[model samples]
Target: MSLLNSLKWKAELQAITDTVDEYDRPKEVRTKVRDIYFVEIGITAEEKYLSQQAKTNVVRRIKCRWDNTISEKTNGLLIDGVEFNITRIYVLPEVREMELSLAYVD
Candidate 1:
């Protein structure tokens, strides 16, 4: 994965957290529960044409896509269409796990 991809993923994760936080309850989710994928935000190279120098210019923008996928299986709870896997379920202090899912993109 490239740096851009990593940063984009982090942003997307934060977005998910924000969305979940707005829920009425701790809506348990699942990952890849349905025929869905993730969204990757970016400016398509073909969207714009620029000179060599212009192409080298860096721009800050936010974009997203729903095409990323995790073709793996593990012990987790499926909610709606998201996956809340037991990434790290502890017993002492608290349970630590992560919910994953393919972005539901139409």
Candidate 2:
């Protein structure tokens, strides 16, 4: 990757890093925890395998530490420690938390 792209990823990674407390601070401090890949349908071989679980049209998957904000009522945050699979996403007002599945972009 170019320096600019590398720097961009690092910057975004730090933003996500700030959300955690000192006690749970990540062991590694770089872009290792914040890397994302995109899996598209047809365009790439990745979609064929991922869409196997579904009977409908092909979809996409990406490895991302999805942005999540916790609600005071729901405890604060959920889905930490990286590795986010975004099959389908929804916002639950009750808990004010974002629920995610385990699927990453190929």
> How many clashes in each structure?
16, 1
Q: What TM-score would candidate 2 get against the native?
A: 0.25
Which candidate number would show the highest lDDT if scored against the true structure?
2
Question: How high is the CA lDDT of each candidate model?
Answer: 0.29, 0.33
Tell me each candidate's TM-score.
0.17, 0.25
Which residue segments of model 1 deviate by more than 4 Å?
1-74, 93-106
**Candidate 1 Cα lDDT to native:** 0.29
lDDT of 2 by residue, 1-106 (tens): 3322322221112222324457886442223333332222222455555456563233432222334632212221112354333444434445333333233323
**Model 2: residues >4 Å from true position, as ranges?**
1-52, 55-84
What's the true lDDT of residue 97 in model 1? 20
lDDT of 1 by residue, 1-106 (tens): 4333443232212111212447566543433333222223343354323312343322222222322332223333333433332222212222222223222221
